[model samples]
Every structure is written in structure tokens, then in C-alpha cells.
Target: MAEKKWPETWQEVNPGCIVFRPGSSRDYHTGTWRAERPIWDNSKCIKCGICYLFCPEGCISEDEEGYFAADLNYCKGCGICAHECWPGAIKMVGEE
Candidate 1:
């Protein structure tokens, strides 16, 4: 019998999948990704589409008035959206 090896990084997991560290309170990025949560800076947002344009998961969306938001269930917490926000409306925060 062979023991299954635990993946050491995010790249080893299937895309859009993540697991928390064994004893930590919150999840951490695995394989190639360090799990990051999105923090919205509402005052800084100018309703620009930069973050929306960069989100690979298509999880962020806007209401009729164009307030941007993330649909949490589909969000993989990838920081590209946050990293690309021109006005700094979005920030990738460590899990609480």
C-alpha cells in the first residue's frame, strides 16, 4: 500500500480549488496560489471596469447603477482583479 502525498502548493490542485492549512484558522494559498480574499474599497472605486475586465472567473459583476461586486460562491479569490484595479478599489486581503 502506498500513502497519498499532500500537495505542497496551489499548482498541484485542480484549477479554482483550495484547501486551508492543517491548523490555521483561515485558508491559505496552495501549490502556486496563496489564498487571498478580496477587500472592496468603495470610496476609491470610480465604477471603472478594470477589475471586472481582469477577473478570470467572471465572478465580479455590477448592478444597474454599475456598483461592482463579487459573487462569492464563484470567486476563487484570485488577486488579479484586485491587482488590476486602477483606482485601488479592490485589494487582496489575507483571510481572517
Candidate 2:
């Protein structure tokens, strides 16, 4: 697949608060601004989907093995996933 291109600055975005099209936010990769990232401990995970429900960016996804994983491409690392994990399976770590 071809790599997605993103706007380099806010000036490239639509003026005002209106989005010309719905779901257009998917076109922009906003994860680059995250200062921290969430790390998942599969051994402790309960698959409750709490993290998935709480994630603002909707980046957590189920893997082929049925284990939940974070898509860093869209995850802004807001820490909500880690906080919502009842099993304490998610931890926040500084972005490398």
C-alpha cells in the first residue's frame, strides 16, 4: 500500500471548526504529538474491552490472536486506555 500523506501544519486544515466531510479526521495522523505511549501486558489482560471503550482516539484493536493491541499510528497516548484497564494490564511509558 502507498504511504499516507498528512498535512504538516494547522494552516493546511479546514478553516473554522467545521469539517467539510464526516470521518475526515482519519486522514490525519495525530499520534505524532503524543509524549507517552501505552504498553499492554497480555498476561494480565482480561479482554474486558474497557480500554477500547475509553480510548478517545479509538486506536485499541483486537489482534488476530484476539488480544487487544494499540495502533500507535492513531493512538495519541492520552493514557485513558491504561487508566480504564481493570486488570491493570496497560501501563504508560515515555515515548522513545
Candidate 3:
């Protein structure tokens, strides 16, 4: 019997079907379905780390200066981070 090879990247996956492989979700870009994108305003940011904590995808990260931002590659644009931001530093903008 031939061994089944697992896809190393998301592009290799068949359309409309997903193969159950360990850690396969990482290979897929879930952010492609996002209708909006999050924009961070450094001026209004308080460095409270609220956005990082509120992110459902855990895509938010802190910078060297203590500012938080999301990685758009994995961010779903759910706006949870922007909505939870106390200082309104994060804004959800429609994708063009």
C-alpha cells in the first residue's frame, strides 16, 4: 500500500475539502474570509495589552515599544480586539 502524504501548506489542500491532519489548521489562511481589517492607531494606544487579551485567534502581539498589533495573515477581522480596546486604539476598516 502507498503511504498517504500530508500537505505541508494550505495551497496544497483540495478545494472545498479539508484533510484531517495534525496541525493542518496552521497551514490554512483563515484571514482570507475577512471582510474588514483592523487598523491600530499608535497615538491613541495606551499599551494596556487589552487587544492582545481580547483577540480570539491569538494573533495579536506586542511590539518592542509595548504597542499591540494583530498579524493580518491569521486575524479573522472579527473586531473583538477593537471592540475590547479601552482607548479605542484599534479600528476595523472595510477591506478594499
Candidate 4:
């Protein structure tokens, strides 16, 4: 896969001032939700490498910053990445 570059801002803000409906599982409601982007808090990461070692598809990589990330093509959104992120650095969050 080619190197994917993220925008300078980590999380983009929603445009409209509409209120977000309560609850976490917004699986169906849609306008432009794309895929589950893996989030990381670099300070929380321990560089333990459990997520990389445990990924069934071997889709995780350690960047120069020492945090792990999943390669999207092979990540089936299994939530295993979230489960195994020991320091809570990696999480599966919806994105558009």
C-alpha cells in the first residue's frame, strides 16, 4: 500500500450546528460516514507492541513516533485493535 498522509489537523470538526443524537452506535444514520479510523494518543502509548503482535492479519505498523496503526485494507473493523491497545492509544472510531 502507498503511504497515506493525514490532514494536518487530527480530527476535523463537523460543519453544521446540528446536535449529535445521544448514544454511541450510529451505525445506520448517514450523510458521509466513511470508515472506522484508528485514533491514537501518542502520550498514552507504551510502545509495548501487543497490538502489532496480536493482529490476526498482521496489519499494524509502528511508525517512527513509536505508536502503532492499522493498515486499513486488512483491518476488518474487528475491534481487536481497540481491545489489544494496552495504553489505550489505538481505538476504532467512525470517520467520513
lDDT of each: 0.69, 0.82, 0.84, 0.65
Pick out the ten consecutive residues of candidate 3 with the lowest summed lDDT.
1-10
Clash pairs, candidate 2, are: none
Model 4 — which ten-residue stretch has the worst lDDT? 24-33
Model 4 residue pairs with clashes? none
lDDT of 3: 0.84
TM-score of 2: 0.73
* Model 3 error, position 3 (Å): 13
Give the per-residue lDDT digits (tens) of candidate 3, residues 19-47. Answer: 45666577678889789999999999999
Relative to the unseen true structure, what is the C-alpha lDDT of residue 67 in candidate 2, on a scale of 0 to 100? Answer: 72
Maximum-lDDT candidate: 3
TM-score sort, best first: 3, 2, 1, 4
Q: Candidate 4 — which residues are off by over 4 angstroms?
A: 1-35
lDDT by residue (tens digit), candidate 2, 1-96: 223346436756556745566676787788897989999999998888888888888888887776788888888888999888889999999987
| Model 3 ranges with Cα > 4 A deviation | 1-24
Model 1 over residues 1-96: C-alpha lDDT tens digits? 122256535556644554434543223323124366777888898998877888876667987988788766567787888888878888887754
Worst 10 residues of 2 by lDDT: 1-10
Q: Which of 3 and 4 is ahead in lDDT?
A: 3
TM-score of each: 0.59, 0.73, 0.75, 0.55
Candidate 4 similarity to native, TM-score: 0.55
Between which residue pairs do clashes occur in model 3? none
